[model samples]
Target: MNVSPPPPVGRCLDMCPMRECKEREQQGRLFRFETLVGEGNWARGRCKMRSLPLADPSKTVKEYSRPAAGKKLSSPCDLRPPSVLLKTVNYLLMEVWDHVNERDLASLAEAYIFVFDRLRAVRQDLTVQRIQGRLGAFVLEGSLGFLLCAPYLVRDLPSDSYDEVLHAKQVRDCFADLMECYGMDPKCPREAEFQALLLLYDLGNMDTINRALKLPRGVGDSPQVQIALAVNRAYLEGNWVRLFRLVHQLDCLQACSFYRHLPNARDNALRVLTHAYSSRNCRFPLDLLVVLLAIDTTGMASEMCRRRGLAVISGEKQSVVFFKASFKDSGPECAGREYILIETKRGDFTWAEIMMGENEGEFMRPKTN
Candidate 1:
């Protein structure tokens, strides 16, 4: 009788993605065997131990006796293979991966449309639910990366680049379709899509973000949408103090079920602000609320109050804490534009004080007694 010894186990290379293979190797090695023609229990459960390798125990051999078990079998499980188009899409994704890995933004921007087209093909094939389910994950990941890079890419283009463009509608339509996929699978383990939209809001691409925000979801109003709106308002109003102030407030915003209601509101707000900041949209609107939502500033909140000459007055429900912000000039620009921050006590409200100053170095004078 001849038997083959078990295979020698070897350490796996680092960063290998073959999880199942690694798991299988955790058990003892697999082996094979050959039976003699005059086997004692050929048709029976009886078995016999074959002759072990007679060579030196420590010596490696060119050949060995056959063992009991046969060759290891292929894994029974495999991911559903993608269609030809999808396989091509995967290849393109690999290219994008390489381009990104190489830090070649120019090449990536050039090949981006090919990736987009392939994704569109996959979207059309979604008439088959399994294909949709399988491909949606890949599509979402790629879409998120693309959306995240959109602001950078768009800003990089020449100002007149879009003047004669006819493809904007097509691109927008594709983006909408991709967003619909993300919406249908809200809990699909793809939070990046939601994160990307938040970035888009700060990137000045409100048109796409607004459309995505309108989709029905488990929650009526996404905190991301609210934060985006706040930042947008700050930009529109040209209030730099308010915008930067919002950045400070966002830093203090805890993910209270009573407030943000989302699990990762802080990170989400940070992403939005970072994206908006990266867009170089320095024009800030002075809306305190918008500034509060855009940046994560905390210590300045109290200083903001003192600078406005606003007294806390009272903490009662009707006589809520109130503070007003106004400039010394009080010109037409400063007339109705100045803001009042107030908290109510028992439903009646009173002015606490007034605040002024866009520059942090200046002092806020309280109202004269």
Candidate 2:
């Protein structure tokens, strides 16, 4: 039996986009600055940056522009398949996969959109969900890769090359805008859609999630929406027990699409949990809280505890204690601690935040001081 290897890990996935940029550069002038927003247009005269290989360009363009005379799609929703459409889909996906593997960002983005549109058009009538699932995964992965890489691509482009930036920005906006729509469109995975976008938030450390820009205008009322918002709340507030629970508890985020990055999310929550418990006067029996931290082994907990300058006693039921060193008191004014690390201020909420809701009635109330 042949089994495929697992997909890349979180850090590897985070860096994959950047690696694609480097790989594209290494391909050495294959892609010209000349834009090809259309599939067949690449063969046209705009090859100023570099002339590309053209094995019968005219024939390729003509054949690409329209299906062969004998083989029209035959109907708006064609399902009369020896599963012939499956073959077409596979060919397109192969082109996409090849472009992606070659790190040809321009070609990959164009082919991704084309394949997605074709898949969606026929997905409704397909007899097998396997193709749909594969395409869905591809779309998710491609969109995520480009989203991570776009800002870097734009930054690397020369300041004088407005055209290249425009092209890169178009590819970035295509999916970001689609996601913006998906987050609001009632026909989607519903309230959980924004949650998936937040998974991108964790992966990319994007400000759009923190500032709440990624959320759609129609969200904010549902339990899942509230729960998703609360996940961020728990994270920001150092409530790791709750944050771990929320990130792993996908009942509210059933259709979240971000993948291979989830283990990173869990690790992050545990790290934060351990960090918090390692704070001053925060001791607790390891057995009592390890499950909430998603800790599976006593050995792992003990190692982490020792590394973080904590003591772990060996026993059938074990316990770990950490000590956070205290700084010297400054003066009489410093007799008691003053709250200075405020991440949010009371009465600082804006009505603009309500745009995340359908109407003001569905808006979350602002926290008061």
Taking all chains together, each candidate's TM-score versus the true structure is 0.33, 0.37
What candidate 2 gets wrong by more than 4 Å, as runs, is 1-175, 180-195, 199-218, 251-283, 326-369
**Per-residue lDDT tens digits of candidate 2, residues 224-288?**
55655666667567676776576555431121222223344444554545556655555567776
In the range 284-352, model 1's lDDT, one tens digit per residue, is: 232342344432233233233334332222222111123222212111111111121111110121110
Best by TM-score: 2
lDDT of each: 0.33, 0.39
Minimum summed lDDT over a 10-residue window in model 2 is located at 334-343
Backbone collision tally, model 1: 46
TM-score of 2: 0.37
Can you list the residue pairs that collide in candidate 2? none
